[model samples]
Target: MIKIILLLFFSLNLIGCKKSEPVKSAEKDDKYGDYYVESSIGDATYLNPILASDSASGDINNLIFNGLVKYDKNIKIIGDLAESWSVSEDGKIIIFNLKKNVKWHDGKSFTAEDVEFTYKKLVDPKVKTPYSSDFEIVKKFEIINPYKIRIVYKEPFSPGLISWGMGIIPKHIFEKGDFNTHPANRKPIGTGYYKFVEWKTDEKIVLEANSDYFEGRPYLSKYIYRIIPDQSVQFLELRNETIDSMNLTPDQYNAYKSYFKNYSKFKYPTFGFTYLGYNLLNQLFNEKEIRQAIAYSINKKEIVDGILLGYGLPATGPYPPTSWAYNPEVKDYEYNIEKAKNIFKKYGWSDYNKDGWLDKDGKKFEFTIITNQGNKSRSVACELIQEHLKKVGIKVNIRILEWSTFIHQYVDKKNFDAVILGWNLSRDPDQYALWHSSQKKEGQYNFVNYENKEVDKLLEDGRRIFDEKKRQKIYQRIHKILADEQPYTFLYVPDALPVIHKKFTGPEVAPAGVGWNFREWYVPYEQRKYEMSK
Candidate 1:
């Protein structure tokens, strides 16, 4: 979840030196020099940012693509590609003014046309992107000129401005057929600080700094992302200095705080929560009593303490505790075995034959929790949940699969009884993508298939009512409803434990997480590791 950026201004002077002689300092030689090496547990599925929703793709996309806007270190909305923008009095119209001299990786000028085209692809049903819902609210989309564009919404969309932060793809290259299988997905061309150089699938993705970047030439010459599937293996690489930065596992973070003098660890609340999600379509979980009983049976605090090692808090709802929409007053289901057993008994589930396992109509109460491989915390949490549920006459199993196959074959196909997973909460608090009943279709975020008329209405109203106070009320109701329903046994929100090598500079953790102002991170000449070709 952490990355570094380099945007150092370089001014080279050769008045007193020969071109053949090597200069040690950037001012004497050149600004760009060293390279940054980071590791990921999975390979990026696609370099095209718009087509990607996973974290691995996002890490690489952040270096390769530029959004119209971005978040500052203070968590404030700031301009990136766009220099400035304004909103109409009604709060439905937005006009953007883009920065000049910005170009794509291929040296094509960036303009409002690219912005318009990006929106076009977002709304194109044939393209199939998860971001289509936000753009669907647009009533009018127009490119006023090369450096300007205007958008009018059908209604007051609260997250409209921030939503534009999504990466803007080039119109010149993507204005072709079948965006799903486009060449740009693998070998991309972008306008960010870094340019794509080379990618060996399941191995590494490399990027070189853009000298003609709108900001400035980056100090680092290269950015390398090494793919190491297992966290244990990644930690080994970190110990060996094979990777410069990594988000450490809770156990690893606690165990390796003083492991080395050349590295430093950082801890902060992440915008995510891990949970045990039930397939509502499964007959075993159809009744609210069964779901509530399962929620009551599991000890969130115990899992957070034992698995997270006192590094996380029990999740009360979908939104993180720091989010404005997070309702603290929402009822918390503390662990109570007696209450859980009574609820199951009320729903015709009990150990009638004293076999110590619940059964109804000769069907034993058994299910599986499928989680992707490579995450030790989730696997351990599953083990603990299984033991807790066993005390209540329920048999549980755990299944692990690779990342890509896990999503494409099992998750998207709805071929699961339950799954252990996590969700990164959106900063804007508009969660229509996850909670809306309509989002249960194939390849959508709401794979849980949870449907409630009231929840849907609140989600719709949460986006329409942009006012902070009014929207707060709408989200509050949604939190209460989900907490009561127990659609997922909302487990815990773990702290992100990111560790980086000490040689890198200009990194300061902020409300938006560690990498918000990544472009500003730099490495001093003496501390720079890699040498550039003179």
Candidate 2:
């Protein structure tokens, strides 16, 4: 069963040395308005919110676009374009009241037609948007008036509003040509706080504040993001003052703690995780006992401590430790080498051959574990797991490939026995794309091919469930079943360390966990001052 945990608990460590510390001016004339940040990753496909996989695009888009609904630091849903909303008695329809005074970057009035058009684009089968599945339950939308919209669903859907919170595109911009090829794609105009100024591929993207923004002009004049793909290199850039901020790995965190203790620093658990996934399509992995044996054999705690170096939290199940849907009552797959061996023997695959390799009908037990390249940490973790499995007489071969080739070949094709990968997580819990029986095949994201009718029903019901407490209970039940099936070994959830220069300051960080809060952040010209009040 696919499970989702829709809670807002974050492990945020507010590490600020002193807010009133003396500011160091590296450059005179105070070009402090230009705060150049760096990213350890690059967007190969610079698409809109519906197409981009990287959270970096989401962060940049937030600055250039306005959604109907937005979340506060505490994840409380607040009005952006939609000022107020009401739900029907049947819980299948939502009526939203939009603000009439808002205007797009191009000076066009923002209205319900724009919101309605955005939803229609996602549901268009020809668009083939990666986010199409998120709106499958949305049956229809009717524009009651220029300032109001009534959305009707096929079934009860509690999370319907937030899912459509992505920035709305003006129907006029898309009418000229396909959004993918339109010049507007590169230079988008939305009702966001900032307007898109320029984008140089693989170089940098710059944004200027919109004076007519509904929230008033942003504090900073301009924001710049320099894209660079190496994490270690990003740390060096931040240290050298070449960039104002970047995300730092745990190893880097320990190396630079002293410098940060005298400045402003913050760390929070990210909405991303790395796990070991098994290919259910493979005949060798079809056996339930074999899957359990692999999951039970490994010592997860050791891998987290050694490879991650205390940077991540051990995953008890598919969800993180902080997730409300985590089933604490469920029995964890603790390390038990003897129990694993016995389970293998009970399944008639115990006896080692003359060469000391486990065999069934004189056939050696072997499989391959794959991982994406570029992430050296994940490759090392896979090698360690290979050694652990070898001790149990199970032959393991490790294969690492480039990130693009790995996702296109091994993962998308379901062509590997196992793989180590990470998931870009969201705040809401909708597991249909990865867990439902219907998505087991096709170009869907469910590479594991896990199928169960019972779980599918629970997920479908949970999607329509309006009560938050009841939805949590349903997900907890689904987590238990996933623990039993063992489609993937839940690894560790890491805390993202986004390195910021001592000069920058901002509002409360977002709980989205992926650190996409650029819209609310600003650099002050006077660095020695306390927090800037909005």
Considering every candidate listed, which one attains the maximal TM-score? 1
Q: List the residue pairs that clash in candidate 1.
A: none
Report residue 179 deviation for candidate 2 (angstroms).
Answer: 5.0
lDDT of 2 by residue, 178-277 (tens): 7655777677787776788888876778877676877666545576666665556666666767766655556767777665543345577765567788
Model 2 regions more than 4 Å off? 1-32, 176-187, 198-200, 258-263, 346-368, 399-410, 413-416, 440-443, 507-517, 526-534
- Deviation from native of the Cα of residue 368 in model 1, angstroms: 1.2
Q: Please state the error at residue 463 of candidate 2 in Å.
A: 1.6
Quote the positional error of residue 484 for candidate 1 in Å. Answer: 0.5
Residue-level lDDT tens digits of model 1 in 298-386: 98788989987888788988878888888989867889999999999998999988899999999899999998778888889899999
Q: Which stretches of candidate 1 lie over 4 Å from their true place?
A: 1-31, 532-534
| Cα lDDT for residue 440, candidate 1 | 87
| Worst ten in a row by lDDT for model 2 | 1-10
